[model samples]
Target: MVYRQEIMLTGAGGQGLILASIILADAAVQDDKNVVQTQSYGPEARGGESMAGVILDIDPIYYPRITSPTVLLSMNQQSFNKYIKRAGENCLVIVDSTFVEDVGNQPAYSYPITARTRLELEKEIVANIVALSIVNTMADLVSRQALQESVLKYTPEGSSDLNLQALELGRQLTHSYD
Candidate 1:
């Protein structure tokens, strides 16, 4: 597999973009690869725009920021518009269809990520984990075992099961092709 892949995840503060990025970065670390994780969050972390960038490669990563991303995931409408413009032809863009009514003209995979996490999974904070699960499945950049292990490693003492469930649920969402 190609090792150098830049992932740009953007969303509202409460949407879990940073958490998802951290999960992806840690998974890369576990794979014995070079990885860099960074974030851009607004003043209102709860409601404001938030983004996390993860770059992983066989070679050491020098800069933390993404120059060009291979994947772009945006939750809120604002973030979708902001980052959609940055996407190239081959980029995979994931949007939370719950809040992002308009996908613009970018290359994307529009999904009701938040809605599925809330209504289907019956969880709130678990949405980010759910979203990351879809990303991992779609890209194949991060292995399934690596991501699951990352969740097991860093999840809070009691929430490991929920996180794993969320990941499984999210993975299921992608296969249905909805």
Candidate 2:
């Protein structure tokens, strides 16, 4: 079967979902897949709503927008409530349990992403990297090497070790969920 994925990552503006989307798109490209990414955030910037869309396919992509996401990552309750309506029936729904209190019957995989990042990693900013790794691992979207390379390439210097640890933690968290 032809491989295709429409992924949407949503959260508050400062949560880094846009960066995650970019990293995912970059990883897809590294794996030789055709990919497109787009993002939008509310006026408040840091606290406002934010969403990023990424589409990956083995064949050429005709549309850049995501109408029905095959995978949805919601970092907060507001984004979860707003974007869950657009997910495909079989979409993989993953939510950050730290900020999202409810899933409302949508079979979602929940993780304490922010809590883990803050408590375990001692840095909450890397929560986006955690979330990205979780989504990538759960969805089996790209090779681990490709994803790791993309994460390293996008993350700032001196932060590679923490980001890699965050990625591994995410993978561990996903396994624990199952």
TM-score of each model, paired residue for residue: 0.94, 0.97
Which lDDT values do the candidates have, in the order given?
0.86, 0.93
- Pairs of colliding residues, candidate 2: none
Residue 29 local lDDT, model 1: 88
Per-residue lDDT for 30-69 in model 1, tens only? 8888999999987884988898999988987898899888
> How does candidate 1 fare on TM-score?
0.94
TM-score for candidate 2, residues paired by index: 0.97
Where does candidate 2 stray beyond 4 Å?
none
In the range 1-178, model 2's lDDT, one tens digit per residue, is 9678999999999988899999999999999999999998878868999999999998898978997899999999999999998987899999999999989888999999999989999999999999999999899998999999999999999999999999999999998866
Off by over 4 Å in 1: none
